[model samples]
Target: MEPTILQGYELAKQLYAKHGIDVDQALRQLEKIKISVHCWQGDDVKGFLFRDQELTGGISVTGNYPGAARTPQELRMDLEEAFRLIPGKHKVNLHAIYADTQEKPDLDELEPRHFEPWVAWAREQGLGLDFNPTCFSHEKSKDGFTLSHPDPDIRKFWIEHCKASRRISAYFGEQLGQTCVTNVWVPDGYKDVPVDRMSPRIRLKESLDEVFAEPLNPAHHLDAVESKLFGIGSEAYVVGSHEFYMGYGLQNNKLICLDAGHFHPTETISNKLSSLALFAEGLLLHVSRPMRWDSDHVVVMDDELLDIGRELVRGGLLEKTHIGLDFFDASINRVAAWVIGTRNTLKALLRAFLEPVDELKKAELDGDYTARLALTEEFKAYPFGAVWDYYCASQGVPVRETWLEQVRTYEREVLSKREQAAAPAQL
Candidate 1:
């Protein structure tokens, strides 16, 4: 783990407590600190999202937490740290765990054995749940990307999983005591479909509504929709928009999770900013980035951070944003290495926020997207640790030390399992 990030977290504690209770005031100060600490990761421009101050920043840890969690109790704590340490204003993001998502059982664990423990851990640690079940396996979504599939059994199977997860989702709200479903990303859309396509979202909505509608809602859980800026029939939205295949989901009032990274390669930065602004203004949940139009989820730095944050704040979505630090392990940071994965992304976002709006606007207007466009030079500054003094001097926020400690204990437990899973079982 980066010592600087820890120091920043510690400072967050000091500043937050300094403010007594007012969450709004404390949040603004922390935003400034976020800008400073986040920028440390890089020398040039294009800092991190977690590192950014302008956005509703949050922190997240990855892979290691899973392996560290051999037992439910241990797992709960790591997540707790994520919740407590990251702070409410900032959302703690989790990868639905591509590996875990794919870890399907034939008959033994018909239901996720870890389901109860996972939820329990989340509540104990004071963290909300965010996930993308499809990354793991479509066994549950066998009906073909949500409700579109024609198989009732497949739909039933996935619905069952949803029901089980609903229990956990409820815990996040009632027990863990969170608000939104934190980023229920369903990458359930088809790519190879022929001719015209219908709303895959409508199908997904009916399916989730069917499950959440059970008297279990209100008490048990709520569902959120993810609007990915993907494509249709091998062409862009202008040509064949990937989101067109999944845009129907956003229309649902349930909830919306906007992905910053997906805007890349597919659309322009402005388009993505507008979508998030509309979503945030409407009080929708926001997911953090690594989007490069067509690129996969990587660390948030470079131009992506600035583009996303500017739109978010300018759009007035920051106040209502339910930020999730979404990440997918890459060659640089694979799954399970929770510490680096989570911290790196957090630092990036934080840095993005720290950027002065005037300068950013000037750059945007002038189209001086040099740093905004390139990733390498933009992030060339930091060696390993990158905390700046000027950034801190201007930052101030209140921290709930007790709550922070509570979540830290949980993160340790969660990361414990991640440690255990470092090596894979023989097939």
Candidate 2:
């Protein structure tokens, strides 16, 4: 560790100690929390199985960024680079479309063998793995209806895909010795106001029931359902709205995935955690930054992110909540996006862990809102950055913006070469 980092950490430690906060204990807690890094960021959500397919189902990755991973191997290489820069061991979140196999298989026909390479890689990296069924961006879903499609055949196909995904998720957990969460998200809705919204929701409920009919070991695998407010095509209404999934999740004992960008711009997911934590089996958070819509922009150290971390710590919900990132910014260097988002998430959690929670609770309970407000505002100026820098150095990652230079070097050597090699041959 740098002398400056040690000196700063010592000062920060003493300052925090004055407030009854144990800096070392906070670091230990931070070390144990892992953020599941989404794999789609490396390749702009364009998985290997169907490279020629257009990203449908209201999903779009803007920007013709250079060096987008063209193959599974390249994506893995980029992820390895990202993992090296990020602190601590974490899980990789995979969608079904990212299947790596010689034989081509449709989504419904996908099996555990299709994702063997991912498991093998995760094992080698000593990391955990999470999964999601790719219910969108397919021929059947081109009409913007899946799961709740009126066509029985189409609904059956998606249901089978979800079932297969659960098995694959279980395989990951069994191999990695960590429970894998298979999140289900579908873009089933109408672009215009529909007269019969009830039928689609009813069909969706039945389909989800059929999908979860098979009982899997809770220790090895868990199921989660994600809801969206609206999408590009489904502008008027989304079939899997929050109310639908929240009720279903509570009744069926499934994890409800609360995506930060999936709700109305005014609504924040931080406030929903406590209420959901009370009834839901578990929660899966898809942390992302949305600019007026579900843009899937890379996450930054913003207010909502901090509030999310604080809620997890203040409510003691870390053990039950699975933290996974969900964003893909094709406009920038993909690997750097991962490092930046993951690091910021850790920083937010660290700040929350270093808070004098007991004191704050006491102030609130004693009807001293003034002190509660005063202390929180005052603590914002504390030397939290020093503790973060020390943690990064101790975890073998670059401290602060120093990691950016390494990313630039990687772009110059590896990513730029990929772009050159992929360029059309000039006559």
Candidate 3:
């Protein structure tokens, strides 16, 4: 590593050691935490299965930025570039629609063979893989209903899709020797006020039961349910509301995906972690930034992000919680978005790990609220940045903003070429 980084880290270590914190131990823990990078961000949520299909499910990726990946190869290449810049080994989150196969198959007909390429790539990268069932952007879900559709046929289609997704998820785990979380998030609700919400929820419950009928080994496969408060058309009632999924997840002993953008504007998922950690079997966190709504903006080093890191570390919930990024911002350079968001997440976690938690807890227990508050605020100005810089250098990733130059070089060469080749012929 650089001499400056070493010098800074030594100073940071001494400062942290004074507070009964072990910088080396913190770095070791940070090295093991892998953040699952979302794949859809590279291509603005457009997958290989139906590239022309308009994004449904109240999900929207804004901006027409140049160099969006056009094929599975291009997407993987872009992801490789992203991973090269980001430190540590991290998993990639793939949706069902990202299936790569010679023979086209419908959602319900999806099989593990279709995702063999992803597993192979993950293996080559020494990384893990996570999956999601794409229950939106399809003809069957055109009417804004999926698992809870009143029509039994439509409901069966979604159920079969979810089941197929589980098998594929298990396949990923079996191939890579890591647990794959298969999250189910359906866009089933009404545009306006609905009188009969109970029936749809009942149907949804039955559909989920059928989807999870065939038990899969937890070591290879894990099931998770994600809930959203409201969406574009479903502004009034969202079938899989927080309350609905929380209860379902607890009763069914499944992971509950808490999306930062899926809740009300004021509510934060950080506070919910403690309660869910106690009751839920596990948790899948969709770290994101919501601008006024479920806009899915790129994550930044903000207060909420820090709080989330603090909660996860302080509550000792990292082992049971699957950390994943969920925002897709097409407005900026897509690859940079991945690096920025993933790096910021790591920084937050590192900051949390470096915290003098025992001291803070003791102060709180001893009714020394002033000391607790003072220490909490005081540590905010500590030399965590030096520690972060050292960590980045140790991981062989570009330190500070130096990574952006590589991204710019990539954009100037590879991304710009793609944009040019994709542009229509000049008159």
Candidate 4:
């Protein structure tokens, strides 16, 4: 053990003890909180369909950062590099489009064999997996809507795609010894006002009913429906708005996915967790940094994130919440983006665990508002960084910004070579 880390943790332990908080127990609990890292960041949402398809459905990935993973092996290698720098065991989140196969099965025809490589990779990496049904960036989805399209053929196609995704998710849980979450989010809305709004929603409900007709064991899989307020093209109305999913999830005994970026800019997801917990069996959080719109930026240790962490811990909802990151920044190094976003997420959760929740709750309940506010303010300045650094060191990962050096070395040795080989000759 490094003398500095040991000395820092020892002092931090005593500091936390004065507030009746156990630093050691907090560290242990933090280790059990796994943040699922998304795979789209490795390739700017360009999956291995081996097609020249542009992203549709109001979704887009900006910037052209060199070295985006172009193959399955490269994406896996990049993810491996990222996991090494982040502390604690985590899960890999996959999309239906990332399947590794030459057959290029349509979304409706996708089978478990399409994702066997991902399952094998997860096994080798000692990681679990989560999945999403890809309903965008394809020919069938180019009409600006799916699942609620006016045409029954298009809606049925997307329904079949979601059904296949559920089976694949169950397979992941069975093979990896963890409950895999399958989230369904379709871009079905309009850019302008429609005469009738109820028809689209009715169609969406029917489509979702068909997708969830065959139930899978809850022990092996969890079904979640995500909603969005609006997107790039669907500015006028989003069919699967939060209100729609909230009612649907509670009625169907399914998890509701609360994406941080899917709401208005002034809204925060942290405030919604407690309310959703009351009726839903569990909640799935799509943690992302939204800039004005539903722009998915890398997550940072900001106030909103801390509030989210605090809510989970205070309400005892960690066990009932599936924490996953959803962001993709192509302007910078994608691997580093993964490391930064994931580590920050873990850090926020750790800070939540370190809080003197019992003490604060008692004060609030006893009408001692002054003490509650004071303690809350004071806890913010606690020696959280010392504990975070110690946790990282104990996990055999780099402490503090030391991980950046490793990322730089990887870029020079691996990423740069790929870019150089692919660059066009200069005139």
Report how far off residue 93 is in candidate 3 (Å).
0.3
lDDT of 1 by residue, 133-206 (tens): 33222344332244444466665655655565555455455655554252344445444544535444445556
In model 2, where do residues sit more than 4 Å from their true spots?
A: 423-427
The residue-by-residue lDDT of candidate 2 on 175-283, one tens digit each, is: 9999999999999988899999899999999999999999999899999999999989998999999999999999999999999999998889999999999999999
- Write down the worst ten-residue block by lDDT for model 1: 35-44
Off by over 4 Å in 3: 423-427
Task: Spell out the clash pairs found in candidate 4.
Answer: none
**Local distance difference test scores for all models:** 0.39, 0.93, 0.93, 0.92
TM-score of each: 0.55, 0.98, 0.98, 0.98
Error of 3 at 102 (Å): 1.9
lDDT of 4 at 108: 88
What is the RMSD, in Å, between candidate 2 and the native fold over all Cα?
A: 2.3
Root-mean-square deviation of each candidate, in angstroms? 11.5, 2.3, 2.3, 2.6
Point out where model 1 deviates above 4 Å: 1-114, 131-146, 180-184, 187-193, 199-205, 212-222, 229-251, 263-271, 274-276, 279-295, 333-427
